[model samples]
Target: MKRFFLQILLCLAALMVLGGCQSKSEIVKLPRPVGTLAVAGFTNPMFNWELLAGYLPHEGQPVNKRVIRELDQKLVQTLGKHGVTAYARPAITRQCQEIEVFENMGSKREAAFSYWISVGECMAADYLLVPQVLFWQPHRGMKKPNYNVQPASVVIDLYLIDVNNKRIVRRIHFDETQQPLSENMLEAGKFFERGGKWVSAMELAEEALDNGLMELGL
Candidate 1:
């Protein structure tokens, strides 16, 4: 009876996964700048990236650096296509920098005149693109039901703030991360596989920026 109930729960979960996805996404816009502006180092066309992955900890997870770099590259390209003129910033490039610094170093409300000071006054970026990733969780595990090994499912939330404006310019939330059990799960003695969604958190950030920029009439 216990095994029977477990199977029922799993089936229900699978159905929920299939039904919860979105086929299309809406484009959002933000208030455009009053003047032509420079891009920040973070938004600059460079290869540095930051990935925030979250696990229950009770479930355990391996730190994936490769994934973070990939996410950064994707975001850089997306923002470039938009009119914001974005790229990687030096403030974001310090090796082994503290997460808290990235989170709080320069804010929109307080960083206007001083922002350039923080970045050495090169004065290229008139606007600052700030993004915070709140969550990144994976669904599924090393063990599969049908058997082929696969990546785990994941969900992420990313938001952006205009540092000079000192207010949130845009935010994006995505929850449809999913995948199916691999065929290898049906076989015995196979190694457990970790499954995950391929969505880049930075992509969410870029979407917010693009929509925000469009709204700005840029």
Candidate 2:
């Protein structure tokens, strides 16, 4: 009986060792960075759409500032929920934009990792969260006199780079399309009402972030 118990313990120990040596893709919880993490290099190529009337900023308002502020705040909140110290520094983002090293790279992923390392060195950050807003567009479908159903589609790519290691620790890609509830006419009307809030896209993005973090076991 003692021999059998010893064999069982050995097998369990072997399994634990194998689990620790598993590939990154198979790993559940990722190792956290050394210290405080900062968000940098957040870019949204959708600035061209600011030409439209609705998206245009009013006097004294910076273009695209509102969206960036909301997104940045959400990221900070998400990291806080995970018990990670995080902050969004606009200066870091501006500096990243000015750097030419990441542009026209042979490997975009490698270039991004290098960029994060550089930023981390400048700020002494343990980790850098790089978020890219790939797509943010709205599609409308319906004829005149019929209620218009518009869907807001957004795609975001988030990369957590370990500054000390100069490598990407995790990458999360999220894509979603959110539309107002057409079945509820009153609610649908409220969505399109002038100056009324339209929260589908924001809600979906938050949900995606939550899901991504949970999947990463972070």
Candidate 3:
């Protein structure tokens, strides 16, 4: 009996060592950076489109600024693997002043541009990106019990503005929404926070960014 117990313990220890080595070998590898990049804060209301519908800015639900920050950081991580670099930050005072001189921007423009220009100056980034979470409902015709869109789709738009030319250089779009799961997997979807539905959207955006870079031949 003692000999049998010792053999079992040795086998279990060997299995544990093998498992650790296998896990380390399976780690995902990411690519390389072309240059430093940025994802600007949404000046537009997709982040708070509800404010434009009828609710006052003060009454509107506060958006988590962290969402934009996290996305920006994620972009950096993704781009790094593909040999691209991106960083989102605010502009400095002097740079903001210089940026103001370039635009005949109305009052709101000055406020918004000031923030971006300062960051752009500090980072000296080659490219700037602006993403919009356009509103959940645009028409304001339907009064639903909740803001949730059935099918839950919302347009995620991107506009690349030229700092020097003060014009839009490029754009991309993403449509994401809640989807129904298969009857067999229904229990899994209900239990998991995201299951796997959002994985595709994340991949889609990464591909879009990669496509954009390819278009630029970067």
Predicted candidate 1 versus true structure: per-residue lDDT over 27-60, tens digit per residue: 4445565543433332211111232222222233
**lDDT ranking from best candidate downward:** 2, 3, 1
lDDT of each: 0.38, 0.56, 0.42
User: Per-prediction TM-score, please?
Assistant: 0.41, 0.55, 0.41
Better of 2 and 3 by TM-score: 2
Where's the lowest-lDDT run of ten residues in candidate 3?
49-58
Best by lDDT: 2
Task: Report the C-alpha lDDT of model 2 over 63-120, residue by residue, as the tens digit.
Answer: 2656667777786677678665545464555565466354345455455455557766
- Candidate 2 lDDT trough over 10 residues, lowest sum: 50-59
Q: In model 1, state the lDDT of residue 59.
A: 30
Give Cα distance to truth, residue 197, candidate 2, Å.
Answer: 14
Please write out the lDDT profile of model 3 over residues 1-218, one tens digit for every residue: 99899757754554444433323225332222245555454433522322112222233333346544544455455446655433544232233334433334555445455444544544465455655544232222222222332333334455554554444455555554444332223223221333433233344345444444433332
How big is the positional error of residue 18 in model 2, measured in Å on the Cα after superposition?
34
Q: Which candidate is the best by TM-score?
A: 2
Model 1 stretches with alpha carbons more than 4 Å out? 1-26, 31-63, 83-125, 132-152, 179-218
